[model samples]
Target: MLAPAQSAADSRSSVEQLVSRMSLEEKVGQLFVMRVYGHSATAPDKADVDANLREIGVRNAAELIRRYHVGGIIYFAWAHNTGNPQRITGLSRGIQRAGLAQPTPVPLLISTDQEHGAVARVGRPATLMPGAMALGAGGSRTDACEAARIAGEELAAMGINQNYAPVADVNVNPANPVIGVRSFGADPCAVAGLVVAQVKGYQSAGIAATVKHFPGHGDTESDSHHALPTIRHTREQWDELDAPPFRAAVAAGVDSIMTAHIVVPSLDPSEDPATLSRPIVTGVLREQLGYEGVVVTDALDMAGVRQKYGDDRVPVLALKAGCDQLLNPPNLDLAWSAVLTAVRSGELTEQRLDQSVMRILRLKAKLGLLRDPLAARREVLGTVGAEAHLLTADRIAGRTTTLLLNEGGLLPISRRSHPRVLVTGADPASPSGTTGPPTAALARAFAELGFKATALPTGIAPTAANVEEAVTAAAGMDVVVVATYNIAADGPQRILVSRMAATGVPVITVAIRNPYDIAQLSGFGIAASLAAYGWTDVELRAAVRVMAGRTEPVGRLPVPVPHAEDPARMLYPIGFGAMYRRSGV
Candidate 1:
């Protein structure tokens, strides 16, 4: 055990020494990154205690650290764990204080899903950087690095040491439900380059960068959160499509790699998900890829990893499969007890536990968390959303406006030619449940650019009443701008767009989430079409700049858009973009 008065710096060089002194329970605890509910370290009220009890069977984060001796804690905005910088920084400091006060006295890794564009856990006061697809469309490795660095600085300021970001998945499947905009792009090489840039960017800012969903999660139509999805890539196909970015990430010296929950039969024929498959996680990621860094599993609470194993068996199987960190297990108590039993029973050797604990400790030391885990509240207040960081975010968002079609030079709509403008569409919440009023935000952007713009809130699937109301509102408008969020082939938003276009008023279609929706508007007589790839204020303003002729469309289609009538035919190729002068003559 560590001496009673020993500081972390005193034993930083001797990780082996610290590990040698740890108890069996402490070693096991160091391998799991559990989730805790509420913003405070200790339970502030019965409500906070009740929420924690419901989620992890713990009373609060302090008890979670003191009792379980957890090595890490992940924050979620929806769990009341984030409000702003002060709250997050204070929570991080409190968690660290609790962790340092423990018998073993090792620092805890504070992590969050601050993936920036669509999946940011920390909201507005922080710089809302562009998403992976946006960066891919921008096609600037420098911007990718700078964006990651800026976001990383903000996260580190808030005392978040680990970030689950720069999703290295190559999004080849257009109909992919989960990873559409989160991935860099469909081209494996391009994705690899951007992944490397982001890895360098994030680590440069003193945050441990994690490249996620190893073996790839991009080609699946099914979401792993609800069910298991199998990627049917052959060994050759896997080497081509799913392996390059992970290879590049490994080469980039990434701090950690998160395993996918999907089963790839080419790698491991056993019907087991990658998180629990020894052949895939151990053989491919460790032996084949030669990755010596920490291997963390995706959330254990998800349905994909829990199909065959019970809650208790899941963590043990993941560790046995060679994962160093078991994240967000459904039943923490059960999982911890099961791992302790496995170690004592020789199903898993203490030596095996030591290997993982050593890796975790090394990562903590590399991130400087071992020396000073607590963040300064005053520094956090000034660094969360610095002016320069927000400017970089705006500049990056400006580079991602991809114009797919502008027939008859319909874009760059002059305020003198078409003075009245109406903006309406589905302002859907992101998959991570971050809500922003994108429709109103877009109108404000347009108005700020000197146009009379009105925003209408038509839900994702516009009802008959919504369509009629929008049409009535569009009667006197000079041009109608509708933002579509991942419109399906048979979605009602198509009807909404077609009806607005039929009114003899020029209509511009902006696919705010995916470029695939632009393919569905072929016969709809839309005057212009472009993809923002996201619906945040930054993206909307970028699109507005392109439409207002203030900026040219420099972003090309990062992923191919299939023909609406035939999936085999391409509507727009991967590098297709229309400049103001390049539109149809």
Candidate 2:
């Protein structure tokens, strides 16, 4: 065991001592993760913001620290003015110092879902790397770890101790709404391996990673954000299909486990969601799986929990059921009211709260955010330089690139002969950014490769529906390059692929999402299909090089495709990404 740092030992004891002496009101502070709208505190939008912002105000940090003594604060991005780390530092420090500043103050825990890619809130919506499905397409144990490390370091610098990310939900159902892009893959073992590496990566950077959506939300076709997704799978199915990643993450020593809001009918006959299920959270997670760390609930504000349980009763049920931290509880007043009532009336034993707080506090101390806020802030913010993005972005693009369909040696269109290229899809601009990536870069890299690439502004490809026009265009073109782009909606360019296939041109279809697109567009019978997973600039250039025979198309398909028509093909046929290493496995 590593020698405990001075901060670790004292900070742990300090937190316990402080919790032990706290009165009912003081301990209540530990239960509330208050959301303060930064906009609510600022300008013209203050009226709307103030209505949502909940804070015990008096701008004085020292005074606020002593007053409510909340365990943590959620940072809502101020759209009018995106906050810089420099600006957030003072506010975060003041909130954090409250625990440390007290004579026996306990260090408060700070958490955020800084899965800061295109899907992130605080940063600009840069071209996000394809989510978990994309990662699965490009199988790299290192990629999972590195991506998480980048996320963790950035969060740690922001004075945020926890990342509610590296989503543990296995994306088994292709139609799974909210979690499709968020989950790693369909295979539990693959998801488990990626999750383990990811957790180690983030923790190595001193950021606590949360493996989430417990009891899994992968099989349902419906979304739980608006309504609870009820899965009919038996307990054995959940263990065989859904539990592996969570178990692997737990075995790998993840700091926190987040419960899903979806109802598991097979696990509980009453149909309570995992967040409020005693059998799942306490029995399975704690007793069966032996998870001893923190168990956080998915946002209580979600309709799954809120609509069914009602606002007043959720906190009581959750605390009793074994959830350690309650996320984004709607109507904080109701939550506190319920918890306080339970505590004062002897409904909840103080031992339960102590158990949760101790685990949380131990995590804070381990991350060192509890010890010296200044040093942690400086260390992270300073290291995230431009060069870091430049290098990692390349590796991410290269490794995550997947080769789904390759029919003939049609790629490597010899530049020396000036192959006539008809480029149909992909964002034409390079995904460039100071701190984030833009989606456009994926296409621009081809133009840089000396490929005579033309981008259609209408976002349609040369297909059979417009056969005469497409055939006329293809008559002189040496290669018909048809590309597919993933949108906010499902199944990219179904009609376009049909049209392209009818033209009878040797079309090269590139699947920019996961290979699951094969089920949608594979019937087109395009000679070659590539799953770049995403159109990052690095992957685009690499794809061009491999096509030209300048580089061998060594990248294998990470997920298998049983056949274009098979429903099971959606999970993935193989776990191969680009940069295929011949000798390793």
Q: How do all models score by TM-score?
A: 0.96, 0.82
Model 1 lDDT tens row, 1-585: 233355566655478888987899999999889888788898546787898888777799999988899999999976778876888788888999998999888899888887776777887778888788988999999999999998898888888989998899999999899999999899999999999999999999989999989889999999999999999999999999989999999998999999989999999999799999999889999999999999999999999999988888999999999999989988888999999999999999999999999899988877766666764523876787899887888899989989988889888987888888999888787534233567787788888888899999898999999999999999999999999988878899999999999999999989888789988888999999999988777778899989998888999888999998898998889988988885456
Maximum-lDDT candidate: 1
What are the root-mean-square deviations of the candidates from the true structure over C-alphas? 2.7, 5.2
Runs in model 2 deviating more than 4 A are: 1-4, 7-12, 39-68, 75-91, 94-107, 116-118, 122-130, 377-381, 414-439, 457-492, 501-506, 535-572, 575-585
lDDT of 2 by residue, 1-585 (tens): 113466556666776775687777667667655555442222224543444444333333344346656666655564222256545554566566556776556666667665433234445222234345556655677887887776666666666677787788877666666776466677889889988988998898787888988989887877778988898788889889899999998899999888988889878777888889998899989998999988888877888887677877887788888987877677766687688888788888888778877777677667765456546544535644345654675556555555555565444456565455666654433222322122234335555677665544225332344434444556565566666654222333665555656776667767554455655664567766666654444455556666665555555554455444555544345664333233455
Off by over 4 Å in 1: 1-13, 43-45, 375-378, 430-435, 582-585
Separately for all candidates shown, the number of backbone clashes (residues 3 or more apart, or on different chains) is 0, 24
* Candidate 2 local lDDT, residue 100: 73
Indicate the worst ten consecutive residues by lDDT in candidate 1: 1-10
